[model samples]
Target: MNLFQDIRALVIGALEIMQADGVIPVGLDFANVTVEPPRDPAHGDMATNAAMVLAKPAKMKPRDIAEALAGHLAADYRVDTAEVAGPGFLNLRLSPALWQGLVKSVLSSGEGFGRSTLGAGQRVNVEFVSANPTGPLHVGHTRGAVFGDALASLLDHAGYDVTREYYINDGGAQVDVLARSVYLRYLEAHGQEVAFEDGTYPGEYLIEVGEALRRKVGDAYVGKPEDVWLEPIRDFATDAMMGLIRADLKSLGVEMDVFFSEKSLYGTGLIEQALDALDAKGLLYEGVLEPPKGKMPDDWEPREQTLFKSTEHGDDVDRPVKKSDGGWTYFAPDIAYHYDKVSRGFDALIDVFGADHGGYVKRMKAAVSALSDGRVPLDVKLCQLVKLWKNGEPFKMSKRAGNFVTLRDVVELVGADVTRFVMLTRKNDAPLDFDFDKVLEQSRDNPVFYVQYAHARVCSVQRKAQEAGIVVDDAMLAAADLTKLDHEAEIAVAKKIAEWPRLVEIAARTHEPHRVAFYLFELASDLHGLWNKGHDDPSLRFLQEDDVDTSQAKIALARAVAVVISAGLGILGVTPADEMR
Candidate 1:
C-alpha cells in the first residue's frame, strides 16, 4: 500500500466530515488538497494544505480551519502529533511504528514495492533513435537511445502497456547516398579501384557490406549502370547497416520492440491515406506560404505547394507536405507513421528526439493532433547533446567513426552498465557531460559508483551477518522485532525508503527517468550516512555479536535499502554490483 496515498485519503475524509457538519460550509471543493512530505524536516513527517486551499470557500479564518482539521486528523492512531503552522498549514508527525513498519512492507513487497498504477492501462508508443542506416550510431543517438529505453521501462513499471519503437529513415535521399557508398566498396572488393565522392559514406563499417554483396552476387553487376544495381544494393546495404545498429544498441543494453520503416509508407498508399483523412477534415490546403517577417509579400515569388493547416492544431504556421514538383516532403511520411500508431489504438504517443530536432516538435504535434482528431495525446522529449570528457579534457573523436564519437566506442571504453547509468545522470532536456574518468571512479562525486556502492555495502553486511552464523533471509527479516529500530537516524533512512513509491509515480507521470537516478543517489547517501554512524557508535552497527533479534531488526533495515536500490538499478537497465573493486 502507498503510505502517501493512504494519508491523503485520510486527509480528504477529514475534510468531507468537516463539510458534512457545520464546521465548514457545504459544497466546498477539496480537490486541491495535497499531502506531501514537509519541506523542512523539523516541521513534521507530512504536511497538508487542506485548510489554506479551502479557507476562501468555507468563509473561515485559516487558523480556525487548521485547528478543526488538526483535531479531526489527530484522532487517527497513526498521527502522533498534529500542529497548526503559519496561516493554514496542518503538519502531522506519524507514529514511529509506521516508519518501522515500512521496512517490513519493503521486504515483503521486494522489487514490487514502488510499482504504481497511475497509468491505468493506457497503451503508449515510444518512438526513439530512428537514426539513418547510413553508419554506426553515434553519441548523439546514444543519449536518445538510453533515454527512450529507460522511459519505456518506466512507463511499464507504472502499469502502462508500452510499445518501444524505432522509425527507420530509409526512404530519404540519405539512403541513396548509403547505396552509392556501398557500391564503391563493392567495386573495390571486385579488384576495381573506386573513389568515394562527396555524397558517399566512407566509414569502414560499410566495407563488410561491400564484401558480402560481392559474395552474394559474384560480380554480376560489377560494371552495370546505376539503374541496374541501385535498388538491389540499397536493400542489401540497409540490412547490413541495421545489423550494425542493432549490435550497437545491444552494447548499450537498449532493445526496441518495433522497427517501423519509412519506406513502407511510400508505395502502400499509407501516406496518401493519412492525407485523405486530413482532407476530409478540411485540414489540407494548396497555397503559397507568406515570406519571412522582414520581407515584403511582393519581394517573394509565388510557389504553389500542398500544405497542412497545422495552425488549427497549435502550430505557428501551416506546414508544407508536398513541394510544387509533386514529391512528398519529409513531413508527409512522419505524419503517416504517427497516424499508423494512432490507428493501432495507442492511447498516447511519445517521441524521443535529439535537441537538433527542436524545431520539428510543434509541426509533428500538430500532425498527430490532426490525424488523431484530438483523441490521443502526444509528448515529445528532446535530449540535448552529450559532451564527453577524459582526464579533465574533452574526449576526442573516434577515428573509426570519422566525424563523431560512436556508441560502440563509448560502451567498449567503459562497460555497458556504466555507460547507461552515466547517460541518465541529468534530465533529458539538459546538457550532460559524460566524463570517462569520473563516471568509473569509485568516489562520492561519482553518482553511478555512489549508488552501486550502497547496494554492494548492503551485500557485504549480509555476508558478515551470515559469517556470524545469523540467518538474514527476507522472510526472517520481515518478521524481525523492528521496534528496536527507534533511533532518529535509522528512522530517517526508513522515511527515505517510504518516498520511493511516491517518487515512482511522479517520475512516471512526468516521463523523466532522471528523477529515478536522482532519488537513488539521495537514498544511497542516507544509507552510507547511517553506515558511517555505526563506525563511531557500536549501537548503530547492523550486526550485533550477541543478540539475534536485534541484529535481524537492524539488518532488515539495511537489506530493505538494498531491495530498493536493486529495483531502481533494474529500471535503468543497469546490473547491481554485489561488490565494487
Candidate 2:
C-alpha cells in the first residue's frame, strides 16, 4: 500500500538488473540510494539519487549510469517515464493510474493505511514528566507530558512496543519541604494559626491534603516533634501531590503505564547493584574533580569522592556517584533507574526531559552506555518552555499552583483536544507561545482548527451524499471506478495521501511527532484547496447531480483524505472532529 516504497523496490530491482547485465559494477552499496518526491513538483512525481551516490563508488559517470538505469526503469508498468535531469538524478513520472489506485488503497486501508513496522516490535520504555512530587504539574511539565505522550503513540503506530512511564522524585529534600508545608496546613486545619515559611510550599492546593491528614490521624501528631511525624507526613504529602498530578494528566488525556518511585531505588540495594555493574567494568574510582570553570567558589577544595569514568563513554568529564560525606549524589539514583530499565530487557530507552535538563543529557547517556555495555541505545528529548498569552498580554499564574499555570488550567480553558494538538504544533526543543486567543480563532493560522475542519468537511460531504441516495461507504468507494478522478487538482491530493506511510516512518525514525502535526496541516491545505476548486468547476464537485459513477469516484478521494487525517490525529493523541462547533 506504500506507493513510494513499492516504486523504490522497483528501482532497486532495476539497478540489480543493470549490475547483472554488466552495465554497472557489481556490489555498489545501494543503502544510500533513496526514492522520494522531487523538491519541485513540476520536475516529476519522484526522484532518486541512485546514480549520483553510486557514481563515485561504481567508478562510472553519473549521467551514463542514470541513462542506463532510466531505460531499465521505464519498462515497469507503474512507471510512465524515467528521465535523467541535472547531470545525474533520475526523475520518474508515474502513471496517473498509480495515483488513482493510491486513493482506492487509502479507502481500503481506512485508518491503518499509514501504520508502519519501523520499530519491528522492539521494546521501548519512554520515561517523562519526572517532576518532583510536591505540587500540581505546571505549564512546563504540560509540554513535556504532551510531547512524550504523542511520541509514545507515534512509536506505537510505527510498530514499537512502547511503555509510558513516569519517574517520581519522591526521594529528595523537596519532598521534605512538602511534608513541613502540609504540617502547617495540618495545624491550620486543627484551628491553630500557622505561617508558611520561605522554604515551605504555600500553595492552597495543600490545604486539602492537610485537612485529609487530620481526618486520618485525628491530631495524633499535632504537637509531636519532627522525628516522629516527618516520615509519615512526607509519605502522605507525596501521595496527595501525585494524586493531584494524575488528575491533571487525566484532564489532558495522558496516562502512564508505570509510576516508578525514586525512594524505591534507595534502601533496596539497587544503587549498589548498578554501581557494582559499573565497578566491575572498572568505571568507578576515587578521585578529586577539577574546579568548575569560571571564578572558583570561596569554599572550593579538592576532596576525594567516588567518581564514575563518564568521560570514557562520551561525557565531558567524570561524574561523582557518592559525595565525600558518603551520601549518594542526585545522579546515582538516575543511573540505577536506567540500569533497571536495561535489566528489564528493553531494546531501547527514551527519556523525555525539560530543556533545563539539557546539561544532564551526555552524562545520563554515558551512564546507560556503560551500564548496558552499549547494548541498548538511549534517546533523550528535551522539551522547551511554553509561554502563555491572553488579551495581548502574558497570562496570569494559577493561584492553585502558587506561582505557575497548571496543566488543568490550560485544558479547562480550551479543551483536552485543543491543548494536546496545540502543544505539538512546534518542535519539542523549540520554545512555543501558546496564545489563548489565537489558538481558538477559526483560521488557517490555527493548525488544530484547520485540520479538524478538513475532517469535519469530509463528514459533511458523506452526510450530503447519503441524503442524495448515494451509497458512499468505504467498500463502495473503494470499489468505485477511480479512473474517473482525472483532474490535476484531485490527483495532487492523492499524491499527498501517498506520502503518509513514508512520513510516519520518517517521524518515528527521527522521534519527532511534530512532523505528524505539520504533515496533517499540509494535507488539510491540499484538501481545502481541492474543495475550493470545485466552486468554479462544476465537474470537479463531489456530487454530479445526474452521474452517480463520477460522483462516487470524486467522493472516494475526499473520504481518503479523512481516513489519513484521522490516523494522523490518532497518532497525536487528539480526537478527529466529526463536525465543527
Candidate 1, 477-570: lDDT as tens digits: 9999999999999999999999999988999999999999999999999999999999999899999879989999999999999999999988
lDDT score of residue 118 within candidate 2:
85
Each model's RMSD to truth, in Å? 1.5, 0.7
TM for every model, in the order presented, reads 0.98, 0.99
Name the top lDDT candidate. 2
Per-residue lDDT over 443-554 for candidate 2, one digit per residue giving the tens place of the 0 to 100 score: 9999999999999999999999999999999999999999999999999999999999999999999999999999999999999999999899998898999788999999
The 10-residue segment of model 1 with minimum total lDDT is 292-301
Measured on C-alpha atoms, candidate 1 has an lDDT of 0.93
What's the residue-level lDDT of 80 in candidate 2?
91
lDDT of 2: 0.95
